[model samples]
Target: MSDAWSHDEVIYPELGRILSESQGERNEEIAYALAICAGYAYAEVKGGADKVTLRKRLARVGLQDNTCKPIELSVDAMFIDSTAFVVRACEGKVAILCYRGTEIADLTDWLTDIDTEPETYSFPQAPDRRNWRVHSGFYRSTRATWDDVMAELASAGPEALYITGHSLGGAMAAMAGVMLRKDQDPRHRQVRDALKAVYTYGQPMIGNVEFARECQADPFLRDNVIRHVHRNDIVPHLPPVATGPFAHFGTEFRYLNDPPGLESPSGYWRRNASARQAGMIDFALTPWEFVARRIPMAGSLVARWRPIGAKIEAVADRVEKAADTLHVPFGRPPSFVCYSIEDHAPHHYIAKLATPGVLSEFERERTSVS
Candidate 1:
C-alpha cells in the first residue's frame, strides 16, 4: 500500500459508460467522472504535467483530443497555487470544472485551510455582496484564479456547466459557484446562465448563516448544489459552526454506510458528534505519534517504561492497526470506523464512486426527481 499523495495515475475505469449515459446532464455517473477529474487535477498540479501529458492522460480514460484542458493558476500571497481542468463533454455543450485539493506537503494550503475568519464577500456583480460573509482563506484562493477561470469558461461557451472538487478544492468550487451565479456582467452572462450544479466531496463550511440563506434563496443553487460526505470524513465539520458563524448549504449525500444514502442536517449532526470525538482522540495522540515516529526507538521505550506503559502500548497497538487498515495514519483516512485523516484522501473518494450500485442508485433517484 502506497501513500495516496504519491499516487499520480488517474484512470476512470467506467469513463466510457459514464460518458455515454450522462449525455449533457448532471447525474451520479457524471459526478463520478468529475471526481476523477478532480483527482487528476491534483496530479496536474503536483507533477506539473504538461498539456501533452494531460491530454494523453485524459485520452487514456476515453476523452477525445481537445475535449479537456488543464489550467494552472497561482497567487503571490503564500504562493497559493490553484489547479483546475476544464472538460468540454457532450459535444462541447456541457462543461465541467474540476479543482484540485490541497497537497500534503504544501504549508500554504494548510495555512489556507486553517484561516477560518469570515470576511465580507467582494464581488462587483452581486447586488447584496456586502451582506455576504465567507471563509477568508477560501475566498482569497478562489479570487486568486477567478479571472483565469472565467476566461476559460467564456472560451468554452458551453450550454451547461458543472463544478466539482475534493477537500480544499471543494471549498473553491463552492465559492466559484456562488460568484459565477451572482455575476451580472454581460460578458459572463453566458457562463453564468450555463451554471448548472456544483458537487463537492469532503468540503468544509464556506460561509456564514446569511451567506447560506442567500444560496438557499437562489433557486439555481438550491436545486443544483450537491455535497458528498463520505463516512467519517473530518473535513466537512471544520471551522466549527458552534464557535463561529460558519455554515453549509446544499443537498448532502452520505456515502459508504449501511444502506448508503443522503442525510438530513440532524442525522449529519449525530454522525458529526461521533467524528468530533474521534478527532479529539486523534488530536491528542498526534504529537506523541509524531515524536515516536521520528526519534530512534522512542515508540518501544514509551511502550515498555512504567505503570502507564501498558495503557500507552495498548493505544499504540490500536493506532498501528488503524494505520494498517488504510496504509496511512489513523488520524487521516476517511473511514466507516473512526474519524480518520486519510479518509479525506482522493483515492477513497475515487474508490467509493467506482463501487458497484452506488452511482446507479444515485442516478435512479436523480432521474425520478427530474
Candidate 2:
C-alpha cells in the first residue's frame, strides 16, 4: 500500500521456515534468502523509509535489527552477510534450497573480451542510424550470453531459480530471465520452467525493439522481471528506444539522495545512496570512454579481430548518438541532478545534443567520428 514495504513486514517467517525445510540445503536457502533480503533493501532505499522503521519491520519476520550489514559489492556480484533466515520455493513446493554462487571456471566468458587483447577493438564506427537493426547486434550478443548461463542452470534441475544482479549484472539477469522463460531443454526444464523471478537493481537498458517484445510476450518474463533504478543513476538510461517489455522498466526510477554514513544509521543509508550513485555513473561512462578513445589494446584487437570489414566503429557512433536522443520521461529530474557537488557534469555533458534542434549535429558527429 505504501511506496514500499519493509522486508520483515512483508516476508512471512512461517513461509521462510517452510521454504528452508523444503529446499533441504543451506546453500540454496542462502541464495533465495539473500535475494529476498536484497529486494527488501532495495525497497527501503527507494522508498526513503527510516532505518528504525525498516528494522522494526524486519523484526516481525524473525530477524534481529542488527543482523544486516553491508559487505563487498562488485560489478557482477554482491556479498551480504545477514543472520536472517530464508525460504525457498521450487516446482510448486517450498523447501530449504541448495545453491552454489558459481562453479563455472571462467565466469567472465560473458563479458566483452577487452582484457587479453586490449587494442583489438575500437568502439563501433557508423553513420547516424536510429533503425531497429542497428541495435540488434549488441542485444543479440548479451541475449546469447544469458541463454548460455541459463542452459547451464537448467542442467542441474534445481527447484525454483531466482536471478539477480546490480548494474551490468542486472542487465545480465534480465536477459537470463527472458531466455529461462521459454527454455525448452527437457533435462532441467522443470526447474527452468518454475523460475520464481528475477530482480535487477540499477540495471541498464540492454536490448532493442524485437528483443523487448519477445521478453514482454513471455508470461514468465512479464511478471517476474523486476528492475529498480536510482533516479539520477545514468547507466540505466542506455540502449534507448524500447520495444515493449522495457517500456515500463525505467518508470519506477528509485531515488536516493546520498550515501549512508558508516558512523550512524542515517549515515549507513546515505553511504549506500552515495555508493549506488557513484557506481551507476561509473558503469555508464568508464568502459565506453576507454573503448571510445581506443585505449585498451584488447579492445582494439576485438575491433580488428572482427569478421572482415566489420563496421564496429560505425555502430559505436550511432549508439552514442541514440543515447543522447532518448531522454527518459520520468516525472522529474532527480534532486541530486542540481544538488550533488560532483566535478563531472552529468546534467550538461550532452545537454545541447538532447535538444530537438541539435539532431543534425549529433548525427553529423556520429558520421564523422567513425
Candidate 3:
C-alpha cells in the first residue's frame, strides 16, 4: 500500500501534482468538495445564498444571454435532449407552452420533434405582472399563450395536460397552470378540471397576486403541481417577488438539500445588503454585469451595447441578490425545533400547526358518505 493509497480511494500526493496529472478532473473534484463544505456553513453564511457561485460558474461556461431584449425562443435547447425528454414525458397530453423570456432558440431541438399533427403555438408577448415594476416579459405574453394552448387542449379532448421545463421553462409551466384556472371558457373549464400534473424543476415565479390566487383556488391544481428546487441552484429564486397571492400555489415545493456524495466550498459570499443595494443603483449604470456582459449583440443592436449591458446587470444583480435572501419558506418561526418524520400531532407534534398525516387520509375521512 502506498502513502497515497491511505483509504479505498486513490489519493494525490500534492495539489500541484493533482492539477498537472488529473487536468480536467481536478476542477470537478474541487467543486464537489466546495459544495459540501458550503452546506455545513450555509446557516452562518450571510444572505443565505444558494447557487450564487454556481450561477456565476454557469455564466463562465457560456450558458447565458447578454441581450437585454425579450426572449422568444423555444424551451428544448437548454439541456441535453430537453425537448425530446419533454415530448417523451408529455406525449398525448395537451401541453401548455410556458418558458422564460424569448430564449426559444435554446429549445429548438425539442420544438422540432413535436408531432406536427397536434400543433403548438405561442402566447402573446407582454411584461410579467408579478414584480410589476420589473420587466420580466413573462406575464402578458404567457397569459395570451396559455389561452391559445388551452383552447387547443380543449379541442383535443378533456384530458390531463403535461407541463415541463428547467429554469425559465419551469416558471412558464407554473404560469400556464395559473391561467388554466383564471379563464372560464367552457372548453378551458373542461380541460382544466381534468388537468394532469405539472412537474417543473428550477422554476422561477411568473405572475403577481391575481394569478397566484387563481392557481391556488383550484384544489386540483395545487395538489398536482410539484416543483423541485436544488438547495444551491439559484435559478428558481430569480426575478424576485411572489408575483401573485398564491405564487407558491398548487406548487408542492420539494427541497433537494444536496447530492449525497458532494462537498461545498468554504468562505460564504457575505450578504452585504449595501452591495446588493448598490447593484440596483439604476438602469443607466451597471447594465451589463456578471452574466449579462456575455450576450452576443445582434447586428448593430444597442441592446448589446456596453452601456445598456451595465444597466441590465445592475437590475439583474439586485434581483438575484434579493431572491437569495428569501430562500427559506415563509411562516415557520425560526427556532431549534425537532421531531421525527413519523411523529403525529398533540404530544408528538411535528410543527406547531401540523403532525404526520397524508392528504389522502384527510380526504378519505372527509368524503366518507354517512
Write one digit per residue (lDDT tens) for candidate 1, span 1-370.
4333212333444454465444334465566656666666666434673455545545544455437666676654754667777877656776778777888877777888878677787556457646678888888888877888889889889777788899999998988998898887899999987777898888888887778867878776765777777754667767654447666776666664333365322122111211121234443444565466356787565334422532343365567667867888554332223233556777667656653323321121112221
Which digits, one per residue and each the tens of the lDDT, describe model 2 over residues 317-342? 34544664785333322212211212
Query: What are the lDDT figures for the candidates, one per model?
Result: 0.65, 0.35, 0.34
Answer with 1 or 3, whichever has the higher TM-score: 1
* TM-score (all chains, Cα) for each model: 0.67, 0.38, 0.37
Which segments of candidate 3 are over 4 A away from where they belong? 1-136, 209-214, 241-247, 258-370
- Per-candidate count of clashing residue pairs (backbone under 3 Å): 11, 52, 46
Top of the candidates by lDDT = 1
Error of 3 at 200 (Å): 1.6
Q: How displaced is residue 172 in candidate 3, in Å?
A: 1.7
Candidate 2 similarity to native, TM-score: 0.38
> How much is the lDDT of residue 346 in candidate 3?
14
TM match of model 3 to true structure: 0.37
Instruction: Please give the lDDT score at residue 44 for candidate 1.
Output: 43
